[model samples]
Target chain A: AQRVTQPEKLLSVFKGAPVELKCNYSYSGSPELFWYVQYSRQRLQLLLRHISRESIKGFTADLNKGETSFHLKKPFAQEEDSAMYYCALLVPGNQFYFGTGTSLTVIP
Target chain B: DVKVTQSLRYLVKRTGEKVFLECVQDMDHENMFWYRQDPGLGLRLIYFSYDVKMKEKGDIPEGYSVSREKKERFSLILESASTNQTSMYLCASSSQPRGLKLFFGSGTQLSVL
Candidate 1:
């Protein structure tokens, strides 16, 4: 069975500090990984995908196949970056498995 | 811009009452999905339709059913609403070749009393 795991339920960091949201997956086949973010009172939206290899809002994620992880990283955390982040894995048949999500709060 | 709209933003209903949550996408996407968002559980797929009149059960399909009579419209139905059924329901749409990118709605917060 394919599964996405986000270990931290809640994380707090100071502004300007490096932030990392951990995401790991359990799948045998080649995986398509994505990160979705939801800010307060806003709709959930796609943050970035591994395939694009493009950074969004200064956030970047690199797929580590050997470690089965696609952790999201940002060099300097911003106050606005505080939000709920979900890691998702897409299977062959259009099925998406989402992680439990991590709530990030960047304190100023 | 792709727009996925859900009929209601917030709803309050009594237990045992039948409930319908409607969703429509304007991008002419080939796939639509229904998901329920909970605090710790994240987003759990309830059902999804790849085409008109075609539906598939998702990770959590119990206590729910779906209808997709039109290509751009998908409806999620709860046969009998229960207190445990209260949740934040989200609707999303995606197109083939770009199916990985999902456009989501504001979500409907439903409360079953």
Candidate 2:
């Protein structure tokens, strides 16, 4: 079965602190990972996808195929960056599988 | 910008009532999806349409149905609304099946009374 796993339900860090949201997957096909963000009282939006190899709002996620992980990283957390982050995966020719999600809080 | 728009931002309905939630994407994408958002569940796909008059059941399809009469629009129908079905309904569209982003709507907050 294809699955996406986000181990942290909530993560908190002080301003300017580095942040990492971990994600792992179980699938047989090629990995296409993505990070989505949802701010308070706002619609969920795409942050970044591995295929593009681009960063969005200082956030970047690198796919580690050896470990089946796609961890989202930010060198420094900002208060405005606090929101719900979801890790998702799309196998070759398949629907997207999303994890439970992680609520990140970048404290001041 | 790729835009996916939901017809209603808020709706209130009673049990056993039929409910229609409509969505439209301006980019004329080939795929549209309906999902329900909950506190802990993240997003669960209710149904998806890849083409006009074509639909597929997603992870959770019971007590719900969908329609896609036109390429740009997708409709989610709740045959008989239940209190448990009250959720933040989200509509999404993608450019393609491979390496594409899912643009989402603001969401419809449906309250089944």
Candidate 3:
């Protein structure tokens, strides 16, 4: 079965510190990965996708096929970026699967 | 702009009562999904509909049922609301070619007492 895994339950970083949230998936074929962010009192929204290879709000994720991982990274953490991050996968069907999510806290 | 809205932001109901959570999308999406958010479970798909009057069971669909009588509306039904069923329910929709990239609504926080 195809599954998405986010290993961190809570990730804490200081302002201007580099942050990396680890995610690994189990899949045999090409993967379509996405990063979704949920801020306090806000809906979960799409941040970026691996297919687009673009950066949203200074955060970028690279898809590593060999390792079967798509880790979300940011050079300088911001207070506004502190939110619950979820990684999702798209398989052959339109059905989607999501990770357990990582709660990021950027301390000042 | 695409928009998905849940009918209720917060609801409190008693046990054994029938509860209905309504969702509507104005983007004319073909796919709509219902999920329950828990602390460690993240988002567990409860049910989904690909089109009007068509529904499919998700990973955990035991205590819940769905109705998609219209293209823009999907309703989640809980036959007998229980304390364990109290959760943050979310509604999301997407297009067919857009694949699994979903646009979500502000979730409904349901409390069963």
Candidate 4:
């Protein structure tokens, strides 16, 4: 079975501090990974995908096949960056397995 | 932008009542999904449809059913709503089978009392 795991349930950081949300996955084949974010009262939206290799909102995630992890990171946290983040893994059948998100709180 | 619209933002209902959550997308998506979001469970897929009249059970489909009569619409049905069933329901759509990105709707927060 394919699974995505986000170990942190909640993370607190002061503004301007570097932040990292850890994620690990278990899959047999090559994986397509993604990070989705939901702001307060906002719908969940895609943050970044490993395939795209692009940064969104100063957040970037790199896929590490050896470790089977795709962790989300940001250089400087902002007040507006506080939100719920989810890690997802896409398998061969167009099925997506999502992690039990991490709630990031950027304190000023 | 792709638009995936869920019919209700918030709903309160009594236990044992049958519930219907409607979702519509204007993006001509080939795949649609229904998921339930809980505080610690994140998003658990209840059902998904690849095409009109073709539905598949997801990770958590025991208490729910789905209908996809048309390509643009997918409906999730809770045959018997329970207090434990109360959660935020989200609907999403994707353009193709290989597409990893999905467009989501404002979730419907359903509370069973």
Which structure among the candidates has the greatest lDDT? 1
| Cα shift from native, residue B105, model 1 (Å) | 0.8
Angstrom error of the Cα, residue B43, model 2: value is: 0.6
Q: Write the per-residue lDDT of candidate 4 for residues A43-62, one digit (tens) a residue.
A: 99999999999999999999
- DockQ class, candidate 2: medium
RMSD (Å) per prediction: 0.9, 1.4, 1.1, 1.0
**Residue B79 miss distance in model 4 (angstroms):** 1.2
Q: What TM-score, to 2 decimals, does candidate 3 have?
A: 0.97
Tens digits of per-residue lDDT for model 3 on A1-108? 439999899999999999999989987788899999999989999999999999999999999998999999999999998999999987765777889999999999
Tens-digit lDDT string for candidate 2 (B1-113): 98889878999999999999999999989888898988788788899888899999999999999999999999999999999999999999886645368889999999999
lDDT (CA) per prediction: 0.95, 0.90, 0.92, 0.93
* Regions of model 1 farther than 4 Å from truth: none
Instruction: Write out the backbone clash pairs for model 2.
Output: none
- What are the per-residue Cα lDDT tens digits for candidate 2 across A1-108? 438998899999999999999999988878888999999998898899998899899999999989999999999999999999999987554477789899999999
Residue range with the least summed lDDT across 10 consecutive positions in model 4 chain B: B94-103
Point out where model 3 deviates above 4 Å: none
lDDT (Cα, tens digit) per residue for candidate 1, span A44-106: 999999999999999999999999999999999999999999999988777778999999999
TM-score of chain A of 3: 0.97
What's the TM-score of each model vs. the native? 0.98, 0.95, 0.97, 0.98
What docking grade does candidate 4 earn?
A: high
